[model samples]
Each structure stands twice: as C-alpha cells, then as structure tokens.
Target: MRLVHPLSVVRDAQDWTYQDVVDIVAKATKRSADRRKAWKWENWGVEPDAESQAALAAALGVPLGEVHRLGWPGWLPDGGPVRTSFPWTMAGTLDALDDTLEHAMPDRRGFMKLGGQTLTLLAGQWLSQTPDALAAAFAGGPVDEQLVEDLESGLPRLRRLEAALGGHRARLLLDTELATVTDLLKQASYTEKVGRRLLRLNAELARLAGFASFDAELHAAAQRYWTTGLRVAHAADDRALGANILKSLSLQCYDHGLATAALALATAAVEGAGDVTPRTRAMLLLRQARAQAACGNRVGCDRSLSEAETQIARSTTTDDDPAWTEYFDPAEFHAQTATCYADLHRPRLAEVHFTTALDLMSPAKVRDLATYTIQSARTHTALGNADHAVHLLERAAQLAASAPSHRNTTRVLTARAELPMTKKDPKVQRLDELLATLSA
Candidate 1:
C-alpha cells in the first residue's frame, strides 16, 4: 500500500500553508505548538489527536473517518476503502446530482488544488459527443408542445426559488425535475425538430441545475452538471447555450483560483458564441473580464469590461437573449466590476463599485444582495474600517436570516475569520453565536 503523507493530503485538498494547518489543528485540539515544532511535525509524521483528526477532515472537506483512512493500515478500523478518484459515469453523475439535491454540500474548499488530469477529463467529457447508455435503456414515447410548455413554465419558478431561498433547495428540485426529463427523453418519442427542442430544454435545465449546485457550494457536482449540460447542448447543436455553459464553467474555475483555466474557458465561450444577442455577449465579456482579473491581467480585464459595457449600451431588447440571461443588468455589471477589483486587492476601487451596486440592488435578487453585502464587508475590512465592516456584516446576517443560503453563510464566516476581533469582542461573539444557529 502506498503511504499518504498528511501534509501532502492537505496540500492537495486546499490552499493553506503548513502554519495555517498547524493553527487550525491547534485551535481544534486546544493544544498550542510553537512554530519550530509545527514545522518539524509538518516535515515529518506524527499521530494526530482525536480533535486534530476531526479538524484535518474538516479542513480537507471530507468525512472524519476518511482522514483516518488516508493513513496506511487504516487507523479507523472497519471503515471502507477511501475513494481516490471522482466517479466518471452516468450513474455516478446522477448519484452525485441526487446527493447535492437532497443534502447540504460537503465542505467547499476552492479548486486551485484540483489536479490537471481532472480538468482534462472534465473538458473532454464536456466536448465529447458519445451516446450515453442510459438514453438507450428505455423506449421512446410521443412528445408534445404541452410537455415542453410544462417544463418551460417550471423554469421561472426554480429561478425564483433559488433567488429567494438558496441554491440547496433549488438544486434538489431541479435534479428531481431533470430525472423526470431524462426518463421522458428516454421513453418518449418525438419528431426530429421536437427532439431537438427537448434536448435544448434538457441542456437548459442541466445548466441551471449546475448553477444551483454551485450556489450551494457543491463545487465538484457543479462542474459535472455543467459538463453534462454542455453535452446535451451539443446534441441539440445549440451553440449559444453551449457558450453560456462554457462561460459559467469559466466562472467556476475562477472561483476556485484556476485563473489560467478560467481565461481559456472564457475565451472559448466568447469565440463560440456565434449569433447570441448583445445582452448575452455582454454577459460573456464580463465573465472574460473576471477571468482576466483573476489572472492579474489588469489591461486585459479593463478592455473586456469596456467591451461588455459597450455591448450592454447597444442592447435594446431581450428578444434575442436566452431566458436565463434576464438578470444581467447594470447592477449585475457593477457587482461584477466590484468583484474584479476585490480580487485584484484594490479595495478603494472595489468600494466604489460596491457602493454603486448597493444602490442598484434589486429587491428580487435577495441572494445577490447578500453576496454583495459580504463582498462590501470584505472591502471595508481591507480598508481598516472594522466598524463599517461589522455594520455591513450585520445587514448581511439579517438578509441571510430570511434567505438562508449556505454560500452566503460560508462567505460571512470566512470574512469574519479574517477580522482582527478576538472571541472576547461582542461582535465576534455574536458572529460565533450566529454561525452556530446557521450550522444547526
């Protein structure tokens, strides 16, 4: 059996230094370690205490027993073999889809540590046109306009639910709907034209499902669903939807700190967008700007943002735009800009855009408002305005109370973790109390 080093496992799973791991372990175990000892243990090997093992599992975003299983001889007796790879099949995809839908996501550490081979496999899966065995399992039945209308009508409601509540519930609902659609497509019959339309609808649902999963912080599931959606889009020859999905994948990569992958994906989205409307084009360009910002290409980022603005200015109607793109307005544009600046560590500039974004915060986009509030709080903290940061966090907390988003909660906790406040501070204590309730 190959021996796996604990530090190496930590490095593969998350972006944290040795000291960071030591600090987390110390806090979890209620044991203090000097820097020298921490470095020595990290460089060597040591049996972890119970709390340290639990903390390592939490930090690596896996089950506690999984951590015990990582060591040779399997320290956690009776535990099953640990999965060294993500499942790569239709059944695996559906199972993961169901998991995301029915359960809260696993701890979502970012994706900078994701292996290059994983990215390659995902990209290949997305671009491949191979027939799925599941599609062939059931006989086809008759397709109709009524069926299409029923599916289409449900879309708006899912979008609303995701916006009003959070991604976790919405993702589950979509997964159930998608399972039904998959069954319909497998068992139901249709003409070539109708089949194409149904495939397009399937692609849309898959893409939305992926977005909901992402919002819920089910990162790996989101990537898989997005790839599946892209495959469906290609079956329908829906280049526009394909581009949209590609752009979304790029955003996911950017969120995970894979800037190079993000830039490549964004570029692919823009190049393949074909005859998409100006609004759609603008949205894609904004995504490119985000990727560029992540790559620290300030000039390129500025150019992309400028191009997006020009495209938005020229867009008159959404008639040519896809239904999924109705939310890309001035406020969203400003919010994206603020995020780019925030990523670049330009808090002053981020502050300017965030303020404008707050002014334009649409009442319908509760989750977006909460996200922006947290981003604004981050900016305030960066600018040494702890008081203002606390105020913004309070507002965010209030919004989160009504919305109940896992993503928002994680962001709030992460931002709070960065603050200089000790547990003795009232605000810090309040945050801890709030987090307890949220996790409950």
Candidate 2:
C-alpha cells in the first residue's frame, strides 16, 4: 500500500482540525472506537497491522514511536512523499504573500527609494485578485486608502519604470496583452468579468507607455498610447476612462503643435462620452476649449469654455465622477485654458487663468509647478514683459532642475528661445544666455 502523510490527507479532505480528522478517520475505517484495533485488522487484502504501521512509519520518514504515540495504528504515515503539485495552492498562496511582504517591506522603507518596477510587480499581483486577499495580507485592514496613497506616492517610481521600458518594449507588451484580452473577451462565459479586467489592464498599460513616451520626448508615441488607451476604455464600456484618455491625447497634440488634431480628439471624446457624469463632461469641454484656443479659434474656444464653466457650476457634487477622474479640478482646467490662451497670444486672459491656477496648486506637485511656471513665463514673454518673463523663467528653471523632467525642460527651453525673437531689448541677451545654459 502506498503511504500518505496524515496531515496531507487532512488538508486534502478539508479536515485540518484534529476533531475533524478523527471523525473522518472513524468514518473511513468504519471504526467508532478502538482506531488501533481497526488499523490492526487485515481487510480487502490491504496491509493493516502493527507491521504495516512500522512499514508506514519508515515510508513517512518519521519514527515509529511518534506514530504509536499519536494513538493510531498508522496504517498510513504521518509524513510521506507526495507527488509534486502546483506551487500556488491555498497554503502556497499564503506562503507567497508572506514572502512578498518580507522582501518588499525593507526595500520600501523610504519614500525616496520607491520605484515603478517594484510597485508594478506588487500592484499587478495585489490588484489582480479580489481585494479581500490583499486586505487579509495587510492584517485585514482597508485596502483602498493604502492603494491610493501608495500609487500617489509612487508616481515617480512609475515614471522611472516607464522610462526603463521605453517605446518599443512598452508597445510590444501592450499589443500582446491586448490581443490576448481580445481573444478572452470573445468567450461568452468570460465576456463581462474578464473583459472588464482586460480593459482596465489595457488602460493602465497605455497610460504607462504614454508617460514613458512623454518622458522620452516622443510626443507622437505618447499620442498613440492615449489613442489605444481610449479604444480599450471604449471596449470596456468605461466612458469616463475613455474621456480621460482622450483628454490626455488632446493635451499631447496641443503640446506638439497639432492644435487641430487636439480639438478634434477632444470633441470626439466629449461626444463619445455622451451624458457622462457632469464633472467628466466639464473636463472634456475644458480640454476642447483649450485645444480650440491653441488653434486660434477664439469664438469656438470661448463657447466651449462657457459650456465647461456652466457644467462645472451645475455639478454640485463630485459623487457621479469616476475615482480616477477626481484628479481634475477647476484649477487644473483653468491652468490648461491659460496655457491655450498663452499659445494663442492672449496674454491678459492667460494671466488671469494662470493666477487662478497658481492659487489652486498644491505644494506637493513640484513637477506641475515647474510646468505651470514655464507656461506663465511664456505668456509674459509673449506680452513683451521681459522682466516678469525673466523672473518667472528663473523660478521655472530652478523648479525644473529639481524635477528634471524632459517634457518640462523642453517647454522651458522653447519658451526661452521665443524670448530672443520677441524682445529686441537688452533682456534678449539674458534670454539668450538662459537658452545657452538650458542647452548645455
């Protein structure tokens, strides 16, 4: 007879408790009392005796005395060789989580040490399953707060991960996953649940790639990420997510001087996200107005802006908006509008919007500060106020140095370049010097 570990049998039978195991054994062997006597009986031509117990003990690699002490004849063993199995069994799952926590905690001790590579791995695993498991791993506490806080604090790490992945690798990974997800979604049984998961994954992948492309100075590539992200969001039937992706794409287009494309994309986003939550509608409208302004469509820009403001005012509560969509506020909308006006050479309007945006900005967003300061500086330069432009530029440069973002650096450099042509005054020399320093 082949021997099996008694504990393994208990686990397999879902009878881990000693009382449950005792009941199971009594039922299996048909012995209400005297388990030893039952084990000593030879029945159905199977080995069942003291000699069998000794043999089972040897097979289990445990001492015979230990088996006898348990008050069992031990026809089967206490510990025996079992067939190799998948490593992700329930017990293994707990073990894996423990091991992951052990490895992750020490490395993540400091906020500065957090990176995208680690967060991606951890988040991918944690977010893949039910929140219950993750909560249990965290000692049965709430997971939502931790997840949000971690993601917010780990944005820089995610940015680095994007940089490390680059365009080609990111594209390949996203395309492959997209194909697999598409196939999965075709199955009737998995159409709803799995489709939603695939859509979320696709959106996240594209967002990451988009950020990477932006960091690498590949605006076109970034646009592609947002475009694909929008498609995936639509497939998932997440209008809010689709609108957000479109907003991002529009901003990319505007930044790259494709103002018309930006407007078109933003318009499409608003239309496709029809009857969406008020906040989302307002955000899309804001993006549309910004794009129109950038393209010099003053009347259209003003109309869109008015519509956005109206929608924002009507949205008395943000409860209808998606969780991710909460990042956009009136300030961010106004700041982007200011950037559009600055691009259109409407300095007064730009200044008003910029001032509003500056007041609304949080101290934690250093990168955003650098970007907005650069935009403000450009607006001042366009108005031929070289002194204010220089001062803003100085502050922007200082912030940019700390943030060290390629996109922000490029924006500042481009703004500085424009100053030399716009200002014939001696300040042009200072602008030239700043441009040289940026180049160096």
lDDT, residue 198, model 2: 48
Q: After superposition, how far is residue 171 of candidate 2 from its true place, in Å?
A: 11
For model 1, give the 10-residue run with minimal summed lDDT.
Answer: 75-84
What is the model-wide C-alpha lDDT for candidate 2? Answer: 0.56
Lowest lDDT 10-mer window, candidate 2? 105-114
In model 2, what lDDT does residue 432 have?
A: 57
What TM-score does each of the candidates earn? 0.73, 0.55
Predicted structure 1: clash tally: 4
In candidate 2, stretches whose alpha carbon ends up further than 4 angstroms from where it belongs are 1-191, 420-440
Q: Write the per-residue lDDT of candidate 1 for residues 97-200, one digit (tens) a residue.
A: 44433332332322222333455445554445343333333356677777787887888887788778677777777777777776666667766666667777
Cα lDDT for residue 234, candidate 1:
65
Query: To one decimal, what is the Cα RMSD in angstroms of model 1 from the true structure?
Result: 8.3
